[model samples]
Target: MKIFTPIIINGLAVKNRTVMAPMCMYSAQEDGFVSQFHRVHYPTRAYGGIGLIIQEATAIEPRGRITDHDLGIWSDEHGLGLKELVSMVHMAGGKMAIQLAHAGRKSRNTFEPIVSSCNQRFNDKYDIPKQLSISEIKDIVAAFKQGAKRAKEAGYDGIEIHGAHGYLINQFLSPFTNKRDDEYGGSLEKRTRFLLEILTAVREVWRGPLWVRLSADEYIEQGHRLEDTLKVIDLIKHLIDAVNVSSGGISPSVPKVFPGYQLAFSAAIREKGLLTFGGGLINSIEEAEQALAKEKADLIYFGRPLLLRPFIVLEAAKTYAPELVIPQYERG
Candidate 1:
């Protein structure tokens, strides 16, 4: 019942709080066009009763893709497929957002040189990225602005900046990866400059609800901690609408995970007078309801669960909010 309630963020109304967390399908073509799989994939969840479906990491540039299969918004041509995707979700009675992202040194595109805040490799298996020059950094920042313009043209109801999972923004924010002594790195304030610039650039075009995903715990002894993340939030909290919280991503090795594992991270960030999205390994609707009921997180995000059970929201809605169970409704 709690999850079925409508709420507004930045003047945009979502039907419920059960968010379909952005999970990469890696199903795009090499050219990064939305494939037949994506056409059916997201709208299925929308029809299944997902409140807000955040499309997986969409690359801002070809070289920024985590893999060649990642969907792209680097050019205007990508908008046609995205607009069709949004139309499908709207027809199914759900709202959707897109996560604009860049891979930095983690990029596996191979043809183009990988880049990062410093000349570093996440690990030996990946290329040791060339340290980004000042001009290159500005170019990437402008790319994000352009991505926002494309997302708006495609009719996304909201935008969630992918600043998590050791991606480009995370690399710049972390002391472990950003060894730059320039204005983009050094003190915490300087370390946050890159993300701030991206946020400012995105705001120039996107007026919809804006959310940002953050890797709350870097999971290494000297890597970023929740304290560091809170400080970063302090700098950009006013720039975005909510922080989608997750953890243990700076390291390639998976950290220990348990039900409600990441809720504490979101709780700590919410204490700073900011809204947050929280869920990791949460298995049941009951646990999700509890998270919202207790106000541990404002939004409950389902990732693996949704993959395993795409119609889970529809099933839950049958008991929780039967009015939304319109499986036969005309959806075209």
Candidate 2:
């Protein structure tokens, strides 16, 4: 029942060990502005007593957006709605973090999905992404810093760099997707350079806690290996506060699923002596407890599960995981 206890991630003390994982609801306007749907949707979870809420995958630039409706922080104007949203979450007593991301070759929302580096055929029909020039890559890094600044200006508690799920950052991190021969590609050090640059750049603008979310593995052919990801982790160890571990997108296909399916990867990283969080297909109080008890993950990130059961944190504490909850919350 360790899941019910409060824990500090990146120097911020969350009320519980549960984090509302970033899930793309795609409820934004074309200009990357957050809409009423976002305001009503996000703060409600805070009221449900969720510990930490990681905002959905937000684009750092226009083309970096995954879908046309994806939220963006590429400009100062995008801060308007986000400011109000943060205010509401604060008033509700929940901590929030923004996930800054870029879709890379996966830009555009048509039936076809464009992938980075290769002119490979997509699972869907869409335009082939134009390979990024060196200058363009620099611009993307700048965009992430700008987004972090906006998040701070908007009153967010912290920011999380999205470096997973085959996004632009993850694409650059993996040799399978990043085929560029410039300094941005080639060796593991080169592939890892982009994420380090982003974390460093955002640190200048964002004074609050910072975290990096990474795909623990990509289920693709010639995809990134656990050792390679660990290398990336080692390189950026000093730049950020903690690593949020998830998997798949390094490869095209994911393996079969079960309860606590990805805790092992998080455990592996955590054993490296780094603070880490586990994500992907984890549900149930027992499973959550197992994650923390076995040191599989320092924290548990709930995506689809929280959507179905918003008050699961309290439920886990009061019902099944009493050992982890406070006596006050457990009393009648």
Candidate 3:
């Protein structure tokens, strides 16, 4: 099936179209060092036959962590453990990418002050974040660049900038959150300036395949929709190799979701002639194959299912396309 077909992007080749989406494991030391859990968790999926595995949201600064235990690349000291994890995933024959992220107002790390594009609080559950100054914004961009460098040093095959899920980048992109009248706010172009600058900065240090995860729709009034996100994509498409499209998380509003609910957004992005990774609530091989056959997305990302059953892709191949099974597991 087309789902199992090999595809290459920006010189990085994967054995198949199955991508393991980044999911925060919240498993790390207080200082954000990789724990033994991460060392074992990621490679397990690689052994189970995932083509590309994007490691969870890794903080670029102490205040950028979603939780205190989230993985971090904020320091050169953090590289060794991540390098070991990458080596393990590569040894298992899986191409891996690291998602460089900053949580902004959504940060739950109480040790440092949270910052965002504006002073808005995500909800009553969190504190109002300090509005980032122009210089501070530049510093954040530099942090992202340094993170990209560390990602390369850690032997990652690619890098994904976390601009989605109401994180720091999303905070700037969403009108509901960013109420600043400064150069980084107001018009859509202005709102996208932060992410554009980030992409440019990261590109300076990491020449590997670059991906951007975007919240394609904010699911609220005065929030970014697919069109808004498309405009952002248009502005930076030249700097990225693929777009991972997922929706909501710009606020507390829950989206009406069903299987493949976000595929339409991916299809729209793909229609604009950009590669996209799309999947939400997708589980079955038939669903994955149908999405590919219908040209809904360039790649399928399996999240919770892969977390629950690491060998799900292997099982799918064994069921419908046994020829695609990894030879190591063919004995079964």
Candidate 4:
């Protein structure tokens, strides 16, 4: 099946098409350091035989955290634990990617005033964020570059920039969240400026399989849709390896979702000449194969299923790759 086949991105040859999507565990310490929970939680998926496992959203700065518990890469000290985490995952036979993120208006962990493309509040529940100044935006761009350096130091196989789910980058890309009239907002090109800067900055420090997770659709009328993202991809495909296609989170409106609801977006984006990581509620290997077969996505990621069954890959290899012998008695 295409699901078990190797695929190359840039120069990185992943052993299979299956990936454990980056899902926030929110289990880090108050200082945003890796905890025992992360040590055990991640490697289990590696032991399960996943080809690539992208770690959850890790903050680039203190105020950038979504919550106090979010993992961070804003400092070198954070690199020590992350390097060990990568070693553990590799020992268990999996490649690791780290998602560098900043929570924007959605941040609830910082005492400093929250900031975003515009002075907006996600809702009354989140703090009212102040609009970012030109210089401050440049500083945040530098922060992402610094975060990529830390990921490289941590021995991560890849780096994924969290440009999705109404985060800082998303806030700028979407029309609904970004109300500024300046260079960082308004027209699509201007709105894409911040993300372009971040990507450019990150590339200066790291030379691995780089990815950007994008909310292809905001699920709101005034927001960006798949077409908008395709345009964005055309501009940045030269700088990154893949696009992790996802939707929603720019607004409070809850979208009607279903299994494989996002595959079409990924397929569309892939058609636009770039690799994509696509999955939305897809739990079956058959579904994974169908997506890969149809060229809907270059890779398939399982989020909740991996949480419940970390051994899904091992279970799959029994049927698809009988030559393997991890669970010796059961496999043979």
lDDT scores for all predictions? 0.90, 0.79, 0.93, 0.90
- Cα RMSDs, all models: 1.9, 3.1, 1.0, 1.3
Model 2 C-alpha lDDT per residue in residues 105-184, reported as the tens digit of each score: 76775433444554443345546676777776778788888888889888888788989888778878887877778887
Lowest-scoring 10 consecutive residues by lDDT in candidate 1?
Answer: 323-332
List the candidate 4 regions with Cα displacement exceeding 4 Å. Answer: 325-332
* TM-scores of the candidates in the order shown: 0.97, 0.91, 0.98, 0.97
TM-score of 1: 0.97
Number of clashing pairs per prediction, in order? 0, 12, 0, 0
Q: What is the per-residue lDDT of model 4 for residues 1-332, given as tens digits with 9 covering 90 to 100?
A: 88888888888888889899999898998889999999999999998888899999999999998888999888899999999999999998789999999999999985567889888799989888989999999999999999998898889999999999999999999889888888888988889999999999999998789999999988889999888888888878889989999888999887889889999999998887778999999988888989888889999999999999988877878888865436543733
- Per-residue C-alpha lDDT of model 3 across residues 242-325, encoded as one tens digit per residue: 999898898999988999999999999998788899999999767988999889999999999998899988888897679867
For model 3, what is the error of residue 305's alpha carbon versus the real structure, in angstroms, after optimal superposition?
A: 0.6
User: Which window of 10 residues has the lowest lDDT sum in candidate 4?
Assistant: 323-332
